[model samples]
Target: MTGREFLEPDSPQQRLYLDGLKRIEIMQKILNELPKADQNLCYQGSYFLAANASLCGLAANHFFRNILHVRKAAIVSALPMAVIPFLSTAAVYDVFVREPLFSGQLNCEVCAVVRGGLVGAVVGGLYPVFLALPLTASLAARYSSSPLPGKENLLRFWLSVSQPVFRKMSWAVLVQVLTGLYLATKHHGIYVKILQQMNTSRDPEELKA
Candidate 1:
C-alpha cells in the first residue's frame, strides 16, 4: 500500500485527524460560551483547559487504571476526564472574569489571585514532563547498560504505585484555586462597599474627598 492511502476516510490516520478537528471545535465552543472579558487572552484560556485535560487524562490512563484494576474501568476512566475540565474552567474564570474586574497591577488582590492561579496551572501542567526527563534518562541508561526482563511488568508496578506522586502535586494546584476564590470573594465585598458609597453620596466633590 502506498503512503497516500492513509489519508482515505476509513484509514486510521484520517480518523485521528478528524478526531483532532473535533477536539478543536469543542475547545472553540467552550471559549465562546465563557464570559467575555477585556483581559482574557484566547490562546491562554484555551490552553489552560487543553493542558489540564491532557495531563489528567495521562495520569488516569497510566496510573489510575493500574491502581483501580476494577471491572468498570471504562466508567472510572471518565472521572479524570470530566473533573479536569471543571478545574480548568475555574482557572480560566479567575484569570479572565475575576482578575479583569480589578484592572490594576499585580499587587491588587484580584489581580494577584488570578495571576497566581494562572501560574499554578502552567507549572502543574509542566511538572509531569519535568519529572519524566530524569526518569527517562535513568531508564535509558539502565536499559543500555544491562537490558532487564519483564520491563512491562515493572512498568505496571510503577503505574500502580505512582498515584501518590501526582496526588502531592494536585494538592498544590488545589491550594492555588482555593486562594483565588477566597481573595476574589474578599476583595469583591470591599469593591461593593466602595460602589455603594459612591452611589449614596449626595455630592460628587464630597465623594471624591
Candidate 2:
C-alpha cells in the first residue's frame, strides 16, 4: 500500500500509526515551548562543564601536593576548593553565555566574552569563601582556645585562608571563561545545523510520506 493508504482507519496498523503521530505531536509541542538551544547546546555545555571541572580538580590536587607542600592525604580533602569554582563557573557560563548565545539572544562575540569573564570573576571570587568555611572553622577550632571565633574575627580569618584558594581558582576561572567563549563560537554554526536537522526530521509531510 501507499504510505498514506497504509494509514487508513480500517487498517490493522491504524491505531499504532495514530498513537505514534500523537506522540510525535506531543513531543513537537514540548519542543516548541522550550528554548531551541536546549536540544543540543545543553548537552554540549554539560560535557564542557564536567571535563573542565575534572581537569581543575586534578590541577588543584597537583598544586596542593607540589606547590603548597600539602600532604597527599590532606590534598584530597581540599579538592573542593579547586573544583567547586570551576563547576559553578561552568554552570554560570551554560546559563548566561551558552543558552543566550545559541538561542540567538546574544549575537556579539565581545558580549559573550564579557559575560563569561564576569561570570567567572563573580563565581571565582565568592565560591572560594564558601568552600574555605570548613577549613577556616577547623583551623579556628584547632588553634584557638575558643571553639569558635567572634563573627568579625571569623570573617577576617576566612578571607585570609581563602585568599590562596581564590588565587589558584582564579586561573581556573580564566580557563573556564576562555573555554566557554571558544565553545560558544565553535557551536554557533553547529546550532543552526542542529535546528535545521530537527525541523526536517519533524516535518509532517515527511512523516506522512
Candidate 3:
C-alpha cells in the first residue's frame, strides 16, 4: 500500500498499528533499564537500518564506554525494545543532535521532522501555523463564553487532550518506513531488470568489438 493508504484511519489494520504505539513506549522503558544488552540490540538494528554501511554500532560502543561521553541519546538508542516507528526525531538523530530529554519539556520545534532540506523548510514554516489554527480556535471559543472560570478549565482540557505530542511522531515514522520498504523492494527489482536488458541490448555495437 501507498503511504497514504497505509496511514489511513479507515485501514483494516489501523487498530493493530495504534496498539503498536503503546508497545513502543514500553520498549523504551525496558531498554533504559538494560543498556549493555540493549547496546547489542541497537547495533544489530542500526546496522540493518544503515544497510551495513559502516561500523557505527562499534563507534557508538566506544563512545558509550569512555572516549566520548553520552549516557544516553534517546529511547531509540537506549532502548532495545523501542520500535523504529515509535521513536521521535530525537531518537533518529545521530551523535550530532542532542539526545532525548526525559524532562517532558519539549519545545515544539524540537519535535518537528522534515524529509530533507526543502521539506524541512516547509515543515518549519507551515506546520506550526497549520497546527496553531485549531488550538487557537478552541481556546478562543472556550474563553469567549459567559463564565470565565469554566472557560479556563475547558482550555486545560483541550490542551491536555488535543496536543499531538509523541503519537504524531510515531505516525510520521511509520509512514516513512512502510512506504520506503515497499518502494525499495519494487525499485530494486526494476533496476536489476533494466541492467539485464542494457547488458543484452539489441542496438549495442555488438559486431564492432
Instruction: Give me the candidate number with maximum TM-score.
Output: 2
What TM-score would every model get versus the actual structure? 0.31, 0.48, 0.24
Question: How many clashing pairs does model 2 include?
Answer: 0
Error of 1 at 75 (Å): 43
* Model 1 lDDT tens row, 1-209: 78786777688888877765553444334334444551244324434444554454455344433343323434444454545544655455556544454332223555545654564454334343234323433433444532323676776655534546567447545644554345454445433444454456566344223
Ranking of predictions according to lDDT? 2, 1, 3
Q: For residues 1-209, write the lDDT of model 3, one tens digit per residue.
A: 66676677867577667655543443334334444543344333322333211122222222222212223333333232222212321223222111121111222232322222222122222232233334333334444422223665967754543344323333433433443243233323333333344355475333123
Ten-residue region with minimum lDDT total, candidate 1: 98-107
Clashes of each: 0, 0, 0
- How does model 3 score by TM-score? 0.24
For all candidates in order, the CA lDDT equals 0.46, 0.56, 0.33
Worst 10 residues of 3 by lDDT: 95-104
Candidate 3 lDDT (Cα, whole model)? 0.33
Between the candidate structures 1 and 2, which one is better when assessed by lDDT?
2
